[model samples]
Target: MLSPSPNSSKKAFSRVALVGKFHADGIEDHLKDLATLVSGLGCEVFIEAETATHLGLSGYPTKTAQDFAGSIDLVVVLGGDGTMLGIARQLAGSNVPLVGINMGRLGYMTDIPFQSVKDTLPKIIAGDFEADTRTLLDAVVLRDGKEINRALALNDVVVNRSGISGMVELAVQVNGSFMYNQRSDGLIVSTPTGSTAYALSAGGPILHPHVAGILLVPIAPHSLSNRPIVLPKHSVTVIEVVNGLEVIVNFDMQSQTNLQSGDKIEVRQSDKTIALLHPSNHSDYKTLREKLHWNEYPSTF
Candidate 1:
């Protein structure tokens, strides 16, 4: 249970949007229930177009993620962290706050459980919640000195070999300063918000979400001396494939693009931020303890 912040006023969320993972089991029912709940709170509900189509729903107004930019006040995401990450990237720079309802194995970003949605959402609607602003990374891929593709990520920008099963050479630089040249499977450039995701699995440090730093973790480095390094939030990192063998750049594990030998992948902090709403009782340490199964003892103790 969460109590409203002392300074929070009873501001209502009039326009809300519902987004969920496509084809997820039981997602239709959850979407229907959430729409009804939001309507009961005297708010208008808009469902994402793809989600509506998957659920066979038509009555409620449907809007594309991009179309909801100025119209939707808040977006309620139902699924795992991956689902939330997808929505977060779409809603980036829109300044729309996101509320996650957990329906996955590990729900780090999606803190609210499905059973608690009915209770938790109402409080959030009444402006009785806390907002945690997280930084986003802007990743751009340059080929032949021309901008090829760009995307925003809430987690990390990974540069790895695509089809070939061998190590690729990558020369890394930070703000024009040479960092290192490594032969490895890949490199994970993560924001603090992404420290616990793939970065942690690659032996990177677990950075608190509030930490103002970016992490560089090499994936399967050939040399044991290569280690994770944390850089300032404002620093720009450029990774050039020195000896590319069909490489690729992945953004938050949601979108990816193939890279060439001379391709340059630049990662930097974006000016936009994501506002994540959480219950007042939310604790990062508790989430870590439960999700990671840490410090559990035997019953006889």
Candidate 2:
């Protein structure tokens, strides 16, 4: 496991922020219960402005992500990994630790279940929890030697065919060295944190969250020889559209942009890291076993 940050002991979560997915079933009740439970612990609680509006609950202070990051000591995300990913990107460099409550399917990152919130929140608020830091990816799109779009992703960055029905050609380069030129459906450049996400579906290896590496997985490559490769965390990967085919660049499945031929996409490790707080008993291997239904059957006589 990667060493915890030196400032982990300095975290005093007196001001907490609540972020949730809008229009999700049972979210309002969960939010209400979470707010009451948090306030009972003698901590000031704030809600994300949009979530607050959606729930139609007034009187509690609400703040945008940018404003909330500056004032809140901790952020409590009440949804699945997708919601956490959105907030993670927003609060990347804020240094505000995040605790996730699992309210959606496949809560790999959001380990805390709704039933355990009552028992878990107090321990976390008291600084009696485990802190795991995860790396993020910074992706930039360049066209004609000029920067066009940039975004951050907690999971993987994907470059795939957009509107066309056929495969596209993409030239790959790493650290100024040519890697490969292939015709495939797309490519996934994922961080260790994303190994179990979309990358896994593409046959990429599952890298532990603490691992300092990036995964390059080809999406349905036409060539049988094409395979996934793990690169150094600091390596800069460049992908250029070679066939003038229209392609889409997706960031953690959250944001996307269209790309034309000759456009270059660069992905690298970001300096910012996400501080994820988990219950003391939380285990990554256990999560994988349960979520992925691995080794569920015992040996039979």
Q: For residues 108-215, what per-residue lDDT tens digits would candidate 2 score against the true structure? A: 888888877877777888788999999999999999999999999999999998776689899999999999999999999999889999999999999999899999
Off by over 4 Å in 2: 1-11, 296-301
RMSD of each: 3.7, 5.3
- The C-alpha TM-scores of every prediction are 0.93, 0.93
What does candidate 1 score in Cα RMSD to the true structure?
3.7
lDDT of each: 0.89, 0.88
Off by over 4 Å in 1: 1-11, 296-301
Most accurate candidate by lDDT: 1
**lDDT assessment of candidate 1:** 0.89
For model 1, residues 170-262, the per-residue Cα lDDT tens digits are 999999999999999999999998999999999999999999999999999999999999999999999999886788999999899988888
User: What's the number of clashes in each of the models?
Assistant: 0, 0
